[model samples]
Target: MDIKSPLPFETSDKAHANLFNRMVNTLVENDNVLSQQIEGITNETLFILKGDQAIQDGSVSGEEYPIGITFMDIGQANDTGYPTRYGFVKNEKISNFRFVQYYYGTGNEAGNYFDSTGIWCRHWWTGSGWTDWHKLSGFLHTNIGTTGKQLLTKAEYQKVLFNRKIKDSHNNFDIKNNRFICPENGMYSVNAGVYIESFQRYANFELSIYLNGIRYKNIAHHRQRPESPSDTGILNTGLYGAANVPANKGDYLEIYIYANYEGDVSRYVSDKSGWFNYFDIMEIGGRNFPRV
Candidate 1:
């Protein structure tokens, strides 16, 4: 059988002829024709098998996975730009992509891991580098040392969870009745007259109560309060806003109310009663209150 040379033919030099002759002589002397054929067949078979396996595994050649990108800061860009030295995957489709920044630092100076704060991605290709691209500001992460705005207090959260109400002694008025009615879950109300001394500062506030641990399923907002005193009125409105509240049995309720306040009130209020004068609880359609 005639053996074909693996090396390309080059007429430029006599060294090529010497190398070809040496290869042919070696093949004949060693009787390597069958071995070479088997080796070639095995490699071809393996290549085909591996190619199928790679396709199944979502592997692509000349593709850069976003996981390979590294971020040095926590700053986020809104429809801004890409980070330095980061590029998109070539010849690939992307969806439901997001970028988030992780905060890492101790004291005054904190660094971010990436740009944006939530999952965001776009189908893109990078032949050279990330340039002249459009990226929306997804989310922003604050450094761990940066003071987070007050979200909610344990007691306030509990009050919303328990759906407690404040009653006026003079009228025996179930002030809880006057506040917002959590239609599906139950009713959660607080008196406008009560004050949490610890959270003295104020800003636009939003109260989110999870009934049965549904999570952000039901949220209430009370915007633009003046100070502690203003929060009282806002709380009252939040409780009695005529909105359908979340209700469920064996449900864990987590209430997160974001507010601009001065200090941490976690240690301040012990229970729902600390923030309100009259603490009462009642189901929206039910008459009796659970004995506590």
Candidate 2:
């Protein structure tokens, strides 16, 4: 990328007026690229202008840089121009770089194993760095009951699997406390799955995310279904849902369920490790806006 000189302008004094006027002509240059024209001046009213916004791609001005596969920061340009760099975004402020791409890789001490989950990126402090794998919190598990005959009260709502089972990776969730306390303030993606089964009467349940003692995201609900009068326990239903929510530090995240039935109901639970149920949490971006 070719970076044009962003000359400093000074017009108050005769010595600085000539140099300032010459730099002003470059401001309106038709070259393509988003330009940040800021000059270091002692005056209170500082003028920082941007070039044409409708600039097209592949323009020489560097306005509207295209980011496809990967990108990185290299910092400010020099006097002659931008220095040659590889893979990274040249002649730009590293502070402005937003998205960071990541690739999936897996290996164990016993054997080398890898499966393609595709490339993913985050606007947060995420990257392809190996250590970033554990930086984000995520988990998966199911809410199964103790006895098949005792669950989902006929007229009442019951928290599935005794609040929530610690199935997948705990991440930021406190297994003992049975709640996910956010470690940072930002936007996050949450998902859940529920399984309902009835031995005799139809199955009925309501799943949701109870945040800060207040019911937040509603996942799934089974109103009424065919009942096995002979108590065969064959009728079953699966509920899955996902949603995005804004959260702040100290906010609590917990899975809740209200099951109602006549005979028996259970939502697939397991005491052993490695449950099929899934509950995932990912931080996307933070709240940042221009202060006008």
Candidate 3:
């Protein structure tokens, strides 16, 4: 991964202009293996060659710029110059012969700053032309605080709030809202578990996973209590639930619990403690196929 950094360019310099144009053309023509960089004034408009424009792959002006991978950042490039705003192009031809684009500035429902948001897409080059772009989803894992969360009312379901994030690969998890917004169209693996503090008899608990405010699956529904009132040594158990949920982009998921006892519930907060209270989601598979 050789980096060509601080490669200065002047707008009025004809030699620099010609070199920049050639570099752009080189990026357009190359498939994968090399990357070139150009540092210049921000927000400069650059053209990308598409559909067999016959540009030389490693020829930049009179010099030969070898190509394996290409990377350039011309901040906020005009929409007229490229299909994706503020996105740089990278070509990678592995065994699949696919071109991949990893980009940010994707506005999300979780109110993530556009530049902080990111996603990846890829398409195949089928000899004739490129295929449609396929967007990939992100993964998320979050959990509650160490002190545990309390259910205020018995027999009434309430949204469980997770205040900590163990993993948020795509910035899709909203900790403040206790929801995971789907970043792309796909099926997700949803899993969550909670341990309620039990100090009474015949206490019941039910946990459900919700998709876009609708109950999608019940992960836990059971009763737990002490075996005997005189039994002083007893610890109740936690409930774990998982489901395969389908969601479109911008769709969100949440977890809710209904308990017959109104009290605090312990959650898995520390790996060393071996407690198991947490929520997790990951994109399994799905694609928006382009019509022939």
Candidate 4:
């Protein structure tokens, strides 16, 4: 039989000759029957239109499948995306589709068991196309104490309470050269009488008064006093003095004494000296009040 080869008969046409040569080269290179079968299968199965259709039609509407929706295993390896669990739904894009894991529990109660002790569980978000995993919740719990009795926040306790002595001074009424001024509008009775000025009450305090740089007396509210002088001379006489004046809303009284040498003391002796003498007067103390 005189067989004819499938070569280009028109040698004058270069394009047709080139096409024929390419066809012959491809056939010679893949001469196996398996290669021919594979080529046929690829041509029948591979369809770009199907791929485009799948991409356009495949969409995950979160309303239909809420969080924690489990997905069954599809036959294809690529289709098996993620395990179904309860958690946040993220990255609802076409390139990535997945299900994240989540859980909730209380912290270590009395017995290290997860109970209702105001502690929360840990959670995470993961998927196929996502590069990194994320933490949606932590294991630590917060203390929600009772209202009004709870600890004060930084913004609530940012203040200072101030208590200051606005004015403090002492008047010496008996100093020979030194004169004394009355803090109140009261009669200055110079005799064996009491002179009292109100002051703030102090608890557990040390009070001291000086006469010409000499330590006159030191006394507290709860201490006993020494015996009075019998001389009646009144000079350097130890007098029973007190500074304890009770005050509810913080008030105080101060007191001093002077002898009227011109009065009834004239019946005593030769020097009827009822004139005022030099006496340096002052008072100082502190009160340990309760803290608010």
**Could you say which candidate leads in lDDT?**
3
Tens digits of lDDT, candidate 3, 1-292: 3533444455888988889977866664452233333333223323343334312221112111113344444245344222235444444434234444333333443653332344555444445344333444333333433235454366678787665677676567887888988766667888888766555456677889999998989998877655564223334557788998877778899988876742444322123221476787766664544338
Please, what are the lDDT tens digits per residue for candidate 1 over residues 1-292?
4555455445768798779768777776566667576666643343322222222212132243333233232223232232222222112223213322222221221243332122222333345332222223322211101011222443344233223422322122223322222222223332121222233334344444444444443344544444445323423222211233334323333333443443333322223342432223333331112338
Lowest lDDT 10-mer window, candidate 2? 79-88
Which residue pairs in model 3 clash with each other?
Answer: 32-68, 33-68, 33-69, 34-68, 34-69, 35-69, 105-114, 268-277
- Higher-TM-score candidate among 1 and 3? 3
Candidate 2 residues 82-195, lDDT tens each? Answer: 111111221222333453333221222133111111122233222321112122222222232222322445565544443343433224566565566765455667776655
Top TM-score prediction, candidate number: 3
lDDT of 4 by residue, 1-292 (tens): 2223355445888999888888876665556554566657643243222322222111332223333322221122242222111111222222124433222222334544322122111122233222212222221111110111111122121111101111112222322322233322122221111111211221121223322233333432222222442224342222233332211112212222222222122211111111211122222111223338
Candidate 1 scores a C-alpha RMSD against the true structure in Å of 20.6
Angstrom error of the Cα, residue 210, model 1: value is 1.3
Query: lDDT scores for all predictions?
Result: 0.32, 0.45, 0.56, 0.26
Question: How much is the lDDT of residue 58 in candidate 1?
Answer: 20
Model 2, global lDDT: 0.45
Tell how far residue 203 is off in model 1, in angstroms: 2.3
lDDT of 2 at 19: 67
> How many backbone clashes are present in model 3?
8
